[model samples]
Target: MKTDKPRVAIQGIRASFHEEAAFRYFGENIETIECNSFKQTFEALKNKEADYVVMAIENSIAGSILPNYSLMMGYSYPVVGEVYVPIQLHLMALPGVRFDDVKYVTSHPIAIRQCIDFFDEYPHLKIVESNDTAACAKRIRDEQLTDTVAIANTLAAQLYGLDVLERRIESNKLNFTRFLILTTHENNKKKGPANKASLCFQVNNEVGALAKVLNVFCHENVNMSKIQSMPVLGKRNEYNFYVDIEWEEAKQFDNSIRQILKYTHNFNILGEYQQYIEDDSPKPQTKPDNTKRYITVKKIE
Candidate 1:
């Protein structure tokens, strides 16, 4: 139950994974607040209702939590840190709830997709969407509803005192959730091994505009970890790029960022921090499929 004693607003209830990630980052007893939407989380931070907001920006199975990406840009907040929690999705329920007795499965979209194998097996069971995977777990715990279950992490079960009837229900084994720690208070303090930086920018609608913008990094031999595009409102054929860079914050880090800034009309450097979980996990034997480029970007719709 250790904590930094800061009021934290997360997107869901106590048992939600956002709370879990927040606890991992800030420790327990964070003077928690719950926000119904990502916007509300930022609002809480702005209005000083909460000192920070912890949220998921991407997943191993789902790419670019698009709304969150835009939200980060819309808000005047800074990404202070990050965490990658291993998503050990579980089929959890109330006591005496047998696997055979379940008729409805509730969770977030990514949770439902991760446990596709289980849903496929229980063809008669309906997959219901909830605001969050752990929120569903918390709901189940509060109501003690029969014949209903949730897919969430072990943290949720531990928080709500629910029985994990089945563990590791994700269709894939290498499930992981990447979380972002956001604060408006200029929290420059970060734990060691910080290597990545998230940035966003919009370029003038011109031929080869993006290429020119990206060349800034290529010239510096800085690696581009990820790049995603979102359309600009009322502007067809124009989009903004959200970029994640494997940045090396040496004496030259700031200079490199400055050079990139000259080429773009609008830009934002969200955060420069270490990969919390990946830095701690065992080195992968091979390049994982989770990092592979996809033809169609899957996002929260």
Candidate 2:
């Protein structure tokens, strides 16, 4: 049963954003194993059903996915890489359907939230939350739902043969989801040069304990790009600090980690991999009413 292509596990069906993120990281040649939930993706990796798991860690609009953070800590999988997929949601329906013909719009809950402003302009359209964006599109096509439309990506529209009624319907054009590429193998053969490191540790509750560890990063000239604190389950007033540090020189990161260990306990280096840096250009701010041009129907006074 050996195949040449690597099997990637994702939390949703094909054409979903998770699949898009997997394709972005592993290219289009790999086989995608769909799972009903994020936990299932990790289970697939654990059971040898998949070679890697593409899991969403955070989104530009929705902030961090806290449940996923706990899953990562529990599974203790190594994050080999990362990828950011732009959440360019589009409204699509049957080929001959028009905007006025749509009565219900369906998408994932998060996707629905991302386009709240667009929905506000069309109160007549009822919102239905689905498990996956692409699944919504597939359901519309499979069931021939003439009065329903789906909010999904371009891949869904093309795969399901639905015409896009509107493009980039998400409230913010800069909205994106950050997905972590995790694998069972800690020393993944495909890992590139490591400039970024993910670590989790606990510092005492006393004053300046957390600050002292951060000061070590500053003293070593290491850039701490992100820090997240999760409360230790069932423990009072105790937390586990998850930090991501990047460095220009490898020595800076090594020295910082060594120094921080003196100030932090239960220190674990989760992963060391090359950071995925999107364009460094300044992002333009998106207004709440940016989708005004697409407002065709007038509200009843």
Candidate 3:
């Protein structure tokens, strides 16, 4: 009943962004179980088919995935860690197939939408919507469709043996998606020291009720990285506030949680794990010189 590698469930197939996120969090040595939907990922974990679930929670351009928030609250799985994946889309086709030979482009609806600006220049190519971006590339390889192109990532291009005709075709190059690592076990030894925590609680509708909790966190010097509110099902005028907080010292976060409990109800700690911080250092600016010629020189053997 024991396997050598951990089976991580992802919302999409291998070579998709979800699988890439999993590879980022857990090393590439692990096994990935593909799921059709976010809910199915949770079910896989619950059914013992997978050891972990990598689910996307938000995106830089498209915004939060509201349904995932609902799924998290419904399943109550502990988030062990998180990772951010840059959504770099590329146009790929069979080798030797020129852009003029392509008559159609296919990808996920969201992926297709992100590359609308690039597709606008080529109005001759018909746009097709599919459930997964990598699947489109896989189909092109399996069916040998010379007229169809797939919008996917470099991983897909390599996995499906396709050539990238166009690189970084997404409208917003800085786009990225934040994925949460969830597990059925409450404690994961692999997760390092905790600095950030995810929580969900409800406060009375009375005035200053929510402010009181925020004030507690502010007084404790705990930085609130993110906060979201979702309406309680079948309950009018009631909402659950989900918050993510970070701190310099553990005491700061601990004190804030204790003080906020007095002003909130139905408080729940979803997860407490180390926060992944991205480097935001600015790069040096350079001026474009049209006078300079840039070319790759090939060396003869």
TM-scores, each model vs. reference: 0.84, 0.91, 0.90
lDDT of 2 at 171: 89
Per-residue alpha-carbon lDDT of model 3 for 5-43, expressed as tens digits?
778888777689998888777767677787778888888
lDDT for every model?
A: 0.76, 0.85, 0.85
What is the per-residue lDDT of model 1 for residues 1-301, given as tens digits with 9 covering 90 to 100?
A: 3245787888876667787788778766457777777888888778667777888988888876888887888886888788777777888899888888889899988788878877787799988998787778878878888889988877777767779898888888887778898887465567776677888888888788888867877877778878889998798987888888776655445666888777786777888777564446453332112321111111223
Please give the distance, in angstroms, between residue 221's alpha carbon in candidate 1 and its true position after superposition: 2.1
Between candidates 1 and 2, the one scoring higher on TM-score is 2
Give candidate 3 misplaced runs (Cα > 4 Å).
Answer: 278-301
Per-candidate count of clashing residue pairs (backbone under 3 Å): 1, 0, 0
Better of 2 and 3 by lDDT: 3
For model 3, the run of ten residues with the poorest summed lDDT: 292-301
**lDDT of the structure predicted as candidate 1:** 0.76
Model 2 off-target regions past 4 Å? Answer: 279-301
